[model samples]
Target: MADLGVKTPDVMTRVSEFMPEIITYIQTIIDNGFAYESNGSVYFAVSEFHEHPKHCYCKLVPSGMSNAELLAEGEGVLSGAADFVSEKRKPNDFALWKKSKEGEPSWNSPWGEGRPGWHIECSVMASDVFRRLGDPEGGMDIHSGGVDLKFPHHDNEMAQAEAESGSGQWVNYFGFKMSKSLKNFITIQGALEQNSARQIRLCFLLHKYNEPMDYGDSTMTHAITTESTFNTFFQNVKAVLRDAHQDDSAKWEGAETELGNAIDATKGRCHAALCDDFDTPAVMAELQKLIGSVNKYLETKAAKQEKPVVFVVKHAATYMTEIFKAFGLIGNGPEIGFPLGGAEGGAGKEETLTPVLDAVLEFRSAIREAARSKNFGDILSLCDKFRDDDLPELGVQLEDKAGSKGVWKLADPAELKRLKEQEAAEKARKAAEKAAAAAEKARKEAEAGIPPIDFMKALKLDDGNTPKYTAFGDDGIPTHGNVGEAPGEELNKNQKKKAAKEFAGQQKKYDKFVAKK
Candidate 1:
């Protein structure tokens, strides 16, 4: 949770720690005539709760009140016990407490040695915590759980809480769900292993919290592309800022005005999107548009050999950073935009390495300048070695620009190394393929140079040693020979025709070979 940037809750209570409270809440429900004591167990009286004037049973999902399969599932593993069905007055009635079997954990209760049921513990714990915090009414504005829990779990929590407090509605809203049976479940650690926390969080933010999210290839690809887009924009902005100088003589221009207007419009749209149930996809679109505007502004200035208005660009970047921080995409720090390294230890590590990297880059730049001045090819190659080889091992990527200006960035060393190896492998593969093709072409040329007489001599018989044919036609094709015991055996009509067709195909090359000779 810390790595993912999720905030810690104010109160964290265990169900076992509140066992007495759970038992008390069940007793209160029984006294209020909304629950009943069955043989050595307790069950919520669904029909009674529904008939009560102030309380409504299964209000969240009224249709699930009569869903036997979902009700049994909500009741849990013991729902199929021999006495489980007989203990309840109605099929829809759910257990508040269950009698313990042999070797099961038990607690001393008025009904018997039994344990609190699954749904009642949550209601009791939440209500008890609220009561201790001076919210004596013990009702909350929101109740959150999986969608699968809407049927009996959440509805039962509502029934139990309202029955105890005499409150009409215990919760105003319910939130989120994920499934394990569908095989879509992933542990936090497992997900973090495959992608950064930002990518995972972005995947969630891209969709509404209540909506079902598909966490597959397309979704993850979007997340990666979205994060890369923002990161690249930030890097480009930083590069512009680095080269920019204070221009006291510069005045406001149309580009500046246009960018400023875009920034203001984006601010409004982003705010409205966030206010509209945190419509993050809309907010992301607006942010992307703002980035596009800023990029255009930078490009226009660069094309004209003019520097951008520093204050205007800074204002836009600052606002963007603020919004990103609010979304928890950027961290609470001085650095703007998402950290290129990652969420864990990225900022601190970059801070430590920045000075050293700058020094190394400066040295490499001096060497490159000297190499250019002296026309020293080896020195230039050495400079390239540092840029292409050494720095990448330390997670730094150096890109050379047109005027020998190089920009550097922090990247994943392992990924950089893999890419380098892949590039080298591809180069080697192409080289090998080229060499094989050249050899094949040379072998064909050598064969083409052979005269018709030598060509016929190269054809061996089935016995492997003797020549197959003793003579050749004019176009370097076999005419007659080992078809009989002597050299003068004439080919039959079929053989003659086949030889004529084969020789016709090679005649052009044969004539060229003879002319060259």
Candidate 2:
């Protein structure tokens, strides 16, 4: 949760801390004839609770089925394997306390040295939350979990809690059951690997909570695209507002009324959507519409000359900021910047690379321009070379998307290392395969009495400018080397001179080393 930037919420409760309260809950239910003890194990009497005029079974389930049918459905069991215990008097009855097995941790309770049952622990913990916070009489306003708990688990908690405390409608449960087997569930860690927190939040908000929703590729992709679009719009608004002068006196006629109407309508729609069961998507839709209207309004009104228009647009930014804050999406950072990579997840060192990345991008932007005019494919190749072979070593990943300039982000260091190792192994395998193929081809040509071809010419690697040097073995096989050039390049005028100078310097060092030897 912290990795996803989820805040430590207030009023957090742990079941372990409320073990004594759990015991007390069981005792109250047993004394009230709502539960029973059999074979040193305590069970909640579902039949008794149903028979009582004031009590009923599983309000959340709301099925007209018999107790046996519901029990067969496995409502309260943690897994399919936890069947009805032999000591249970009724099939619908659930354990409140179980006899501690050998090596299992045990707590001394009125029933004996046993651990509290899963269902009872939540009831006691919920009660403890209310008790410590001064709301024990009614319990918390809401208790939420997946829809699977509607049967035995949540129903049992409701029965135990209400039976013990004499409260009604202790929690208003929300959310539908999502089946993991159906592949509708994605863990936070898995989702975060490919998306930002804001994108995930928006994805959830877009779907209705009561309906089953699949967290698949399409849903997340839409969220990512939408998040990027929203960020672009936000950055544009900031740029406009920063330069536009603010003046209350310099007014544009009817501008105030038009802008005021838009703002009021937006606020009303936002408020209405929130009131209707906290429909975040609806609120977002309203905000998106307002953003569009503000942008269109800006196009017509000159903010510099008509300062009043800028004043109105400032309200628009302010309103949007407030809405953003409400959803906990406001502080995107100091300014609009390149997205950070995953390796910076728990580390707060992303800022240290900001200037470095900016410089890289600036240099690459210039290189791209030079490549475009001069037809220097090598420059583009160098960019890709850096992206694939060099930048990854520093935990950076550069990606090019259709219809937009490329974006770069930090990659996880471990992932980068794994990828680099795999690439190296693949390159090594390919090189060996190429060499073997070449040697076989050379042997075939020599057998046929064909003259040995220049190795670089055979490889289609000999550009006109760079000179190639070769030495022949006694067997007439060529040992090849290139001078004044590198792979994938034909040196230009200035480059040739520099290459010549460097080659001369290296030749002098080599001759001295041979002389010393």
**Highest TM-score against the true fold, candidate:** 1
Worst lDDT run of 10 residues, candidate 2, spans 450-459
Clashing pairs counted in every model: 0, 4
Supply the TM-score for candidate 1. 0.72
User: What are the Cα lDDT values of the candidates?
Assistant: 0.78, 0.67
TM-score of each: 0.72, 0.64
Pairs of colliding residues, candidate 1: none
Candidate 2: lDDT over CA atoms?
Answer: 0.67
**Candidate 1: C-alpha lDDT:** 0.78
lDDT of 1 by residue, 309-332 (tens): 877777777887888788887676
RMSD value for candidate 2: 19.2
**Candidate 1, superposed: residue stretches over 4 Å from native:** 132-136, 181-183, 248-250, 340-389, 403-406, 410-517
Q: At residue 278, what lDDT does model 2 achieve?
A: 77
